[model samples]
Target: MKSTKLYFSALLCTLFLFTGCKDYVRGNGNSNDRPDIILTYPELVSMLQHYDKTRKQQFAAAVGKDEDTRINHFNLKDLKDYIAYIEKECKKKNIPLTGINFISGAYPDNYRLDPKKSNYQALIMMPATTIDGEENVSFDPFKSEKGKPLSLKEILEGYSYTSWTYDELKSRKSKKKSSRSTQKGGGNDLSPAGNRTGISPPN
Candidate 1:
């Protein structure tokens, strides 16, 4: 009887440990225990090269050469603060903050081709949630106050981004490759390996 009781207690504890947090999905909870297959720096270079080519071919005429924003990277502190703010807001409304959705968008016509601007064509990161488990919604910040969801234009204007130029991206990739080769040849490893399970867009 004692052994059976102990086994049952252990099982209950295990279940609780796994299912205790239900705030969000994806990387959270035991439902997704498998490790994500992260892309390498080289792989990312290939992917972004393709994307850059595609973006230029598709939107160059409309947005102008080297003016259509191909990528946007955020500051770590800003991203963390934004996530925390969204979580608090969602909690107040009893909505589970499922994930952030990066929806592609364009700025207003006047700012579309400005090299000085951070958002010509950009991805708007919106907090996502499900309504009654049927319809999914991406919550737009400032929607309640302004009667319009936050636009990519507004977001870019408000927050600062440290996006890299296309030339910088190629330069970094070359440096990363060179460093890795030196490390393989028994040279001192100055930096951490780039082969990790996470998406780190060029900064």
Candidate 2:
């Protein structure tokens, strides 16, 4: 009887541990000032890259590249550093930020691509504080009374992006040497209907 009771209790605890947090950044939970929700760095990057490419004139002056510059920005190492910097900033501001675990945004069981660094660029619903100081947590992008929300645009205005230039990528030939197009995947996949899963059109 004792062993059986312990087994069920252990199972219940495990389930709670995994499901309760939902992969928010894990540090300094004991705070009223922390952002109820946070947008991870990669999420911001994906948003800006889309705007930079499609919006054309709007971001051209801000990003300073009028041409179609496929801003691959940083490598894996650089991304980790950037995330750390955000974490540091949150700490300084006495605000807690949450992050999520990335999963393969791909489909079709046998498709080829690295899933860890793939699509799933959707803003998640957590909690957040309004500019008026009320914790009206919602899915709407974080904003203040002052201006547009802080995101990659703010980051790019000062950020020094590393190079994965489109021209550079184009110069290299894929090892496959097959019918597959010689295009470097932007770490995303497509749906059966041929939708760009990563930068899907916003609804």
Candidate 3:
């Protein structure tokens, strides 16, 4: 009886180990507890590629390309090569990155309202203000107006962004992978980085 109980217990433990708990999903939950990090352009492209290989091919087709030039035409490799340089720029800007938002870069002008519709619009949060020092690190990359910043609640629900905290994102990292530019880069910019601000978060 004792041996049977031990075996069962071990089995239960193994099952629990294999399946951990699930936190928030689909951009649900407040970021009050932790800082949010946005992925750079290169980072965004890598994630999209990781999650969906077909998307790139589809994107290429949509663009009337002869071949699937997701990396070559987009300058994905160049972005990867310049990853260090980009990190330095982020540090200088003090933009906190949490996780990569996986979406296509096809819709930059808000052509589609639902982020799910476009398949490419990773919206990373800019860093919040420093407490004791307040304005020192306060940033509002999503601000639509002079004193008003776009609400995260609104952004998540409307845009369908999947946000993971930094630790969670680190766990998702794989040995494979790393950008073309919409972001500022090797003079080969692919996408635009977030509007990292040095201003204070509005009251």
Query: Which candidate wins on lDDT?
Result: 1
Give a tens-digit lDDT track for model 2, residues 61-115: 5434343223222345645564565445445454444442222222333335534
Provide backbone clash counts, one per model: 0, 6, 14
Off by over 4 Å in 3: 1-57, 72-97, 100-102, 107-203
Q: What's the lDDT for candidate 3?
A: 0.38
| Pairs with steric clashes in candidate 2 | 24-99, 25-98, 25-99, 34-96, 36-127, 37-127
| Runs off by more than 4 Å, candidate 2 | 1-67, 98-130, 133-203
State the TM-score for model 1: 0.46
| Pairs with backbone N, CA or C atoms under 3 Å apart (clashes), candidate 1 | none
Error of 3 at 72 (Å): 8.0
Which parts of model 1 are misplaced by more than 4 Å? 1-37, 41-46, 111-115, 140-203
Question: Model-by-model lDDT, in order?
Answer: 0.49, 0.37, 0.38
Model 3 C-alpha lDDT per residue in residues 11-39, reported as the tens digit of each score: 99988876775443445466345445666
Residue lDDT tens for model 1, 1-203: 99999999999999898899544556465655655767789998998898777766677666554446555666666777778987776565555666776666555555534434533566556676543232234444433222223222222323342241211233334443221111121234222101111121212
| Every model's TM-score | 0.46, 0.21, 0.21
